[model samples]
Target: MNGDDLTKEELLSRFLQLEQRVEELEQELTQKNKRIEEQNEQIEELEARLRKYENPHTPPSKRRSATPRSPTSDSDEDDDNVRTDGGTPGRNDGHDPEWRTVSDPDEEVEVTCDCCPECGEDLDESVGVSPRLVEEIPDPQPPVVTRYNRHCYECESCGTATVASHPDCPDEGQFGVNVIAQAALSRYEQRLPYRKIADRFEQLCGLELSGASAWHATERAARAGRCEYEQIRRHIQDADVVHVDETGVKRDGDQAWIWTFRTAEHTLYAVRESRGHDVPAEVLGEDFAGTVVCDGWTAYPAFTSNLQRCWAHLLREAEDVADDHKKGERIHRSLRQMYVGLQAWLETDPTVRERAQMHRSARAELTSLVERSETDGAVATLLGKIEGGLDHWLTFVGEPAVSPTNNAAENALREPVVLRKIIGTLRNDHGMFVHETLLSLLATWRQQGRNPYEELKRVARDNEMISRAQAVPVVEPSG
Candidate 1:
């Protein structure tokens, strides 16, 4: 077995065997690396899919149902708070019965039982009477049809023709101002489709109306309210603090955006083809001096530097992250605590100096939070958003007029979003115009505590006056 005793052929054979073993090990390593690569790709795909269900932007209505958990040993303790049987079965004792009582009755009827229910005893005189008021709507009456004969006359001196105008008749349209106002209100306020609105008119008023006619009526209302809509736009530009938000919509089979600019006093909506900074620029103007309370959409900062990033949106994003990562949970808790503390501090009506100090302190705390290294992708992404809008997060703390969240704009958008769901897409540019115009007037009027229907009727009357005045042909003096 010694080296001197071994033959050259035996040594060569041993060398070949060692080489074969090394080649086999290299081949096995390559196979293991390929398997790892394949597994990594699968993991990436799974995370991407999970994001659809876990991301901050995904609404709860769209999110997937969570996996149900099995009962633990403490299930009974948890069950203590759960209402297994639908809340307390009946009304609580000591609560007085409530009902509306009309002071003056439009009409009254006496109810005297002819006989007793239990026995066949005749009862003629009533001992006591209890009055119960029932309020009901009267049956709808048919709309009135008025015919006007516009008298045409020629001026004696200039030989110019003139027409006499009446307040009862509009210059052009067949439908009256009231019908047009109702159509616009029904379409926007009630969020009814044109066809349904026409059907409602026919059913309720015994008026014959087509969907096309309903649409034209809304268009006319929109035209009349354009001035008021412009006024609201001007008001938005002049506001000290405006909450802004946008939602995606469809117009004529193309993507569009509906932007809402809202203050405490007024609300304005704009339906635009672009969801860019230009839309805000056009609405608020490039030199807008007011602070905008909005979400972290890139377009907002592009429009103006004064901003209060929505804390609700940031907290929701953190909550999304916390569902998966432990670090994210800590971040979410910290953000919630900060928000709650800020709200409580605001409630104390802090002075300007105190507000400044609080802003500085909050900014420092946010910087510290952002500085912490996050290895988890979800946590890192959330931190990235915070870091990007670090300056905006504390704007509301310094500014008393601004709100910390963009809830106003968000709430204003709910009605339009519901309308969007009902009518998938606006048919054309005219439809988009009508949508933004009528919605703006309706929202503004409601915010201002005006009856929208009555206000619209006033607008219609003004429009008729303008139209009739413009219709009169004036001839210049013959030179």
Candidate 2:
């Protein structure tokens, strides 16, 4: 065993054996490192998935289901007394019954007792009269069909042909303005499918309408409203504050986006193939000076420097992280308290100096909160978000006109989202155009408190006039 006593060959063989053992150990170490790396990746993936369930950004409809509870014991006596039929039958005790009376009557009918039921004797004595009114819809009537004969004449003075136009007729379509307007309302406001709209017209109005006709009617309405849509877009650009948001949609099985730019008076929707900064820039223009209220999506910051990041979205994310982490809980509490305090300060109708002071104080407090060190992953992520949006977190405190949330844009998109769910996808680009134009006009009319049906009819009539003007050639007479 001693080196001095061992032979050269024995020493050499021992050295080789030691080297071989070292190589085997190195290979084993490499395999173990690979396995550890694989496990780490799996752990990260699971955490990400769990976060989706825990995060407030994930809608309740999409979140994982909670654990099922044990079945309730039907043997319990208390269960028998629970009323499942919707509460008590009558209204609450303090409420009074309300009966409507009409001031004007369209028709009147008088009734008198002609015979006594007991003895079959005719009696016509008017002592007292009680008036009762019942309102009912008249039975559906067939739609009136009118045919317009547009006569073409050649002007002898200029050798040009001109066509006579009628106010009741549209230049291009067979249906009148009222019919087209109703079809558009049914499709956009009521969110009815084309086939359903056609069926409804056929059953209710005795009009044999095809799905294609319904679609064509909507297209005409959209074309008519295109000017109004552009006007809304211009108004959004000029607004003092605008709320912006986007949601995913599909067109022809390809990914698309629906962008909403909303103000207090107007709502504009754009359907585009892109969910990038270009969409906003195109709508608001690159020189837009108004403040935009939006969420923390990267596209927004890239589009505009003037922004009020949505506190609702931030608080939701913070609330999610706070559920499991202590540091995050503290951060969430601080943020919420600051938001509430800011709101309270705004309610007092502060002067400009006061607003500036409050903004500075709130910004400092936010900075202090984000400065706190957090070892938890969720907490650190939240702090990073706060730090990233540090400048925007207090923008609303300085500007009284701007809102703290993008709820307007979100609310405007809700109806369209429901339509998307029902239809699954817009069939083509024409469908997208129809939706964006008609939906924008209808929403804007509603926001402005205008009668949608009347407004739509006006737009349809205006479009008819334009078409008629375009169709009739103007001839110049030679002097």
Candidate 3:
């Protein structure tokens, strides 16, 4: 009787302990389920908000134009009545109220003509006569060729020879100014390849421009315009927040990399032999101080004052984790939901513009969710990294004025990426430099709120010593 009683008591105790553990697990599951539901709701609401803000049919802010209103037929009577009141009421002012106009007048001149004085008639033809155009030359002029002969003189004492150096053209060759300008503009602005550009010159200008000559022309332009590239580099250095991305570029039958660094003010890129940290170090440098928002590449972490990891990159990582481990699904869901919350919080409320307030609210909510994720096991692993990076997550909110997304530099990288993909990078280092330098120049010009072609034209025409060409009209032939 004693053995049986003791065995039954032990069995009941074990059963009770298992029941309690099951209850605890059920409660934790319930809490996580509720949090997941709330996050989903937050995402849906935010999506709706984003859609409303991003609706393209929505008109931009309407601004009143400064032009004076034209008097309509209905208003003409009232205006006439006002004028008839002598510019006061009830008196005729002798001015036509209907006559409302603005003027853009050209220079005017008057000349007197004397003819047939005895006949008391003015001459039909005058000394200051209008010219008649009997014929028109559609393709009017040929370029004037200018030559500078460098003289060499040997001094008997030192046996040294000196010659004059022209400032605009490079030392090696006598490529025409138009040829160099055309090559550079074609490569940079038109994004044409060397062979195609040479072909185009041959077809249009009747000049047999070799691809090598075309390449050389562009290289010379890049060298001579080095000062412009330097200016862009300096601007990027001084930028407050820089977005950086790199893409593969081929050069000289070898793999190369093109790294782009850009900000609100400027964009500067370089073609490097390697995709190592040296590229970022060269572009951003060892002592770079500005905030860098980039993907989770180790190269950027060294020099940046603050590192803001790209949310888009994290999303990809989270998805990969979820696919690998089923337990990671919950964390991926949470991240997706959090992105929605961010979108809603950013766009739904126009009144909440304070960075401090936004940061505090986001941190508080994220902190709460993170604390609850401790018991979820493997699902919490990804969440833990995100929670650890919470400070960087709120970096966007820290600057209320700047956009929270790294879209600008990301977009800037896309063109180069496609170009590399299509054209298969550059044939050599010179091609890489030519591509990046011009792309940076154009990108920076657009970023500064100017027309790139217009700027190029102005630079070419006004700075003749540098560009060595007149700004010609860029017109396509009529079909």
Candidate 4:
């Protein structure tokens, strides 16, 4: 009786285990199928994009058309000859063809020899010359040994005379500032990991360095340039208008955030624990006053300055409002009509005075729509916000000093956002600040009408700061 009971219990357990395994397999299969479907959808989308550029006569990946259309040019009579009906007639060189050659077929060839071979008559016997690919030679920057003088003197006339002591130099075995800068640039801009940078130094430069050594050097360089980083942040805050954006980043084993604040003429970045108002507050400083243009992120409004909302983001929001039927269709129709009317008004300005007049009228129309919607529904709420901000959109219509959009500032930080997506974030808050601050300086320098590479080169060559790796060294005693 005991054996029979135990056997029944074991059979029941095995059956339940089999059922669970089957369920797990089914779930995995479903996920796999879903992934396959998504991939197929992406392939179809890419194919559709490719079709836009596809001409039956062109090969894949290569552009098909030989000539590009000049929009404002008068139509040609023979597809090659310029119009001669009314305006000044263009020259019919006959050399000008309908289709342009990508590579020159009529390029002259050099004659190997001018002397005749078959008959005793001089003839032109030129052979086609093949294009020669030239290899670029990089400029040589051989390291020079630069010595610093430490003069020692003693005045022994009095008994209290003593020798002038010299401050200790950097450790003998560590890399110089130039080497450290190269390593930092390689790791930061080139996105190489510390160990990989160490490997590169050993293999390429005949220097044996450890990952820890590279990290120390980078940390030292970043710390030394903190003042310059602060200066860059100040520059961003002082700009006329600022655009703000954020992207997800990783820190150690957790998720983090990277904030980018860029103006048309400046850029500043700050890595924060949370994507909150404090990030902009810290980077922008306490007394910062400028027109901050950003998406409708709640924290963005906390800044104590006139905020100019991005029209592009507002347009997308308006789209959502239209999709939601909580408000009547009249709201959607109203928004569409207002935008269309505004676009038309924008094009009618022939002079500065006319442009100002047109802008004022358009703003008034937008304001009237807002005032009418004060007692209405969901669309009304959205329209009220847009209408209230109508003045911001019109601010640049006639003013040459302002930009019509926040695209320039957005463009400044787009690459950094992409980088954060690719490489993730710094390990800790300190590491995050160092990375963001240095990169901010690099980005702002480039935006401030200066060359980034040139600045980096100057820093690498002229800066005499010591890396953390060279803090201590073994001393050899002489007899």
lDDT of 2: 0.87
Q: For candidate 2, lDDT tens digit of each residue in 343-372? A: 987999999999999888888888888888
Best by lDDT: 1
Output the number of the TM-score-best candidate. 2
* C-alpha lDDT score of every prediction, in listed order: 0.88, 0.87, 0.68, 0.64
C-alpha RMSD between model 1 and the true structure: 7.9
lDDT by residue (tens digit), candidate 3, 1-479 = 45466687787897899999999999999999999999999999987876554332211211111223336535444543333212334324785566435444344455556778688777775656563323333452334456877676765655555554455433557675567767877876677888999888877667776899998877766665566888888777777788887767778878877888888778888888777777767776677777887765567655554867677766656776777677677767877787777777767544545657777887887777677645455457667767767767667766644455566767788668666766775776667777887777777887889876555544443344533332232345546
For residues 1-479, what per-residue lDDT tens digits would candidate 4 score against the true structure? 45466687788897899999999999999999999999999999987876555422222223433344358765663554433232224444575656543553444544376667887677575566666433444554445445556455544543333333222233332566666667767766787888998888777666777998888777755665666777777777787777787766778858777787876666777766688887788878767777677655667767644666565555545655666555545555665676666556666545789778877876777676666544456666677677656646565556544555555555655666667766665678667866886687677776677765556545543333333224334345545
Candidate 1: list runs displaced more than 4 Å. Answer: 1-54, 58-104, 111-124, 472-479
Clashes (candidate 4): 0
Ranking by lDDT: 1, 2, 3, 4
Candidate 2 vs candidate 4: the TM-score winner is 2
Question: What TM-scores do the predictions have?
Answer: 0.80, 0.81, 0.57, 0.58
Candidate 3 vs. true structure, TM-score: 0.57
| Sliding window of 10 residues with minimal summed lDDT for model 3 | 56-65
Instruction: Identify the superior model by lDDT, candidate 2 or candidate 3.
Output: 2
What's the CA error at residue 88 for candidate 3, in Å?
A: 60
Model 3 Cα shift for residue 171 (angstroms): 5.3
Checking candidate 3 for backbone clashes, the offending pairs are 84-91, 85-91, 86-91
